[model samples]
Target: MINANKTLSLAIMSGKGGVGKTNLSLNLSYALNTGGNSLLLMDCDLGLANLDVLLGISPESNMQDLLTSGAKPSDIVIPIEQGKKFDILPAASGVPELVEMDEDMQDLLFSKITELVGGYQYLVLDLGAGINGTVLSFAAMTQMRIVVITPEPTSLTDSYALIKVLHSQHNVSDFNIVVNQATNEKEARETFNRLNMACEKFLNIKLKNMGYVRYDPAVTEAVRRQIPFIKYAPKSEASRDILNIAVKIQKIRMENMGRLSERPVMKKFPTLDD
Candidate 1:
């Protein structure tokens, strides 16, 4: 059983769609779980929820049910990997209104989320791509914000745009970058360096290169098989890359915990409008 305490919340977001944000989120959750930490992966892509689709499970309840029916958070959570590891809060797909939940509603939902995930060690939010009010709000609330990008020019442009928006609007300075689907480490470093230089020159923000995942055919095969690449092809290069990233995340958390002992106070959760 997970200890009831403050859970480390992480939002995995991307500047544009099809950058493998959701796939990375799922695999990262599995990697964290394999390390013996309980986690909750929330599908925050409200309108097009498909984390369940990836796992090949059908959820009877979703975020809409929790909102409309006043369902207990536990009632809506579904366990995966035989209930021994990760739990998921599925979202209703094709519900356009859910994509733009107001500030009060978002706050209310997160309060419930805080309660529901308090026992777990981490809550991973798989946010929708692009910069929108909903995405900004959720990303601002989390302790760690991971921005996924690729080597494509469009991906790089949109990612820098996202960082600028978050920084200027929400005062979010610290950001972790993950390069996905890179052909090689050289390509990955080149991508990160380009983005890093841009952010430093323009936004004056330091972006950390969390790590990069190599493009692998096994990722597509895992998707087709409806299993996470980490599980489907544990020996694949992409899986190993994700595991390394997960380790870095764990190390970051530990270092933050040590710092917290000195500070002994938590930062206020940023309001959606703030």
Candidate 2:
């Protein structure tokens, strides 16, 4: 169990699917856990839950069970790394009802999440891709929102669209950008700069570059083997990049702690009225 002080909530989202969002979320959680933080990784992709598939763990129950059956959050949490560092709340894949939740359901879901995350140092939500209502609600509530994108023009455009929605509708200003599957640091920086310029010019939002992950074949191999790349290939270029980003995240948390004596007030989950 983590300290009872306060847990930092982070939502990792993408503008579109197949941008390696789930892969990055899993590896980043592992890296943060290995670096001595207790984390709860929630697979918020209600329609397609792949975190359990990536880890080769078949969960008996998931967020769907919790929402539909009134199951306790503790009942669905699966421990990882010998139950020492990380826990995962898997989602029910291909469940249409879990995709677009109504107001009451959303409130019930986040209430359970708040209860479950109390003992965690960090709660990492791997939200579904795109700018759906559920995704926007989770992103708006989190203390840190990370938007993952690639060098593809469509990826950049969709990411900007998501950011714009969050800014205009949800009043979210701060965002952390991660460039994934880049060939080199230069490519990653170029991608971030392009997105940053657009966001600044139109939305007037500044996106902090959270660094990038290099394109590594080992990542594909690890995915094929259903193992997290950080553990499967600790020395791989992609794993190294993830670790660097984890370090930056830890530093950001420490800096935020210094500035705020009390726990930051998280935005409430959006209701139907919202």
Candidate 3:
């Protein structure tokens, strides 16, 4: 179980699109909420938002309404289900300004979001693919960062690049790795090892392996049906792997609870109390 005193914020990101980063974020969130812990899944994909689409929901208001119309954060949050303690702060798609929001706009969003932080134990941000200034800033704000990758040459190269930028520019050294679409456990380890080797040698960073999710047809069906794979096929291989990963991550969070200090590097994203 997570500590209630503070929210364990995690930013799930990727180097490129089409790597199942968003899907992993959605399902991982559901898995983490199994202990009746409340979580707020924020779609920080900005200009290309789509968490609402995957959940088969269309909210009346979103982050846009809060920033532009002075809407309350409570009014914009959409509960994933009536009884489940899960909610998502969906973002607007095709919004140009949202892609590269000015520092004032970011501060406004962060301030508004901080108002509701006390109500949830988790704040899971599904960031847009690739590394932009917005992506780096949001990724740094979170206590944990999970980089999703597949067993592809491009994925390895691009993911390394993303990690490099964060570590070199933003001073974000710690990162978690999630291997997606692996055919088997051996394949998954090989993928992680190859990426780890590159990082260890060149970037001088060690990535915590959060385990892997094998390719499963159930995932495709779940997406097609606009539902999470964990809900769609609870007994599936992919679902099992994700739940296991969630357990691993929970253990990590518990161990690091005492050291979950706020990154004081980004002056623009300071806490309201700061």
Winner by lDDT: 2
Error of 1 at 51 (Å): 0.6
Model 1 scores what on Cα lDDT?
Answer: 0.86
Alpha-carbon RMSD of each model = 3.4, 3.6, 3.6
User: Which has the greatest TM-score?
Assistant: 2
Ten residues in sequence with the least summed lDDT for candidate 3: 264-273
Where is model 2 more than 4 Å wrong at Cα? 1-5, 258-261, 264-266, 269-274
TM-score of each: 0.93, 0.94, 0.93
The residue pairs found clashing in candidate 3 are none
Candidate 1 has its poorest 10 consecutive residues by lDDT at: 264-273
lDDT of 2 by residue, 1-274 (tens): 2233367778999999999999999999999998889999999998888999999989999999899898999999999877566999999988988888877888888777666687777789999999888888888877788899999999999999999999899888888999999999999999999999999999998889999999999999999999999989999999999999999988877767533224432455321112
Prediction 2 TM-score vs. true: 0.94
The order of the candidates by TM-score, greatest first, is 2, 1, 3
List, residue by residue over 9-50, the lDDT tens digit for candidate 1: 788999999999999999999999999888999999999898
lDDT accuracy of residue 82 in candidate 3: 64
Instruction: Report the lDDT of model 2 for residue 206.
Output: 83
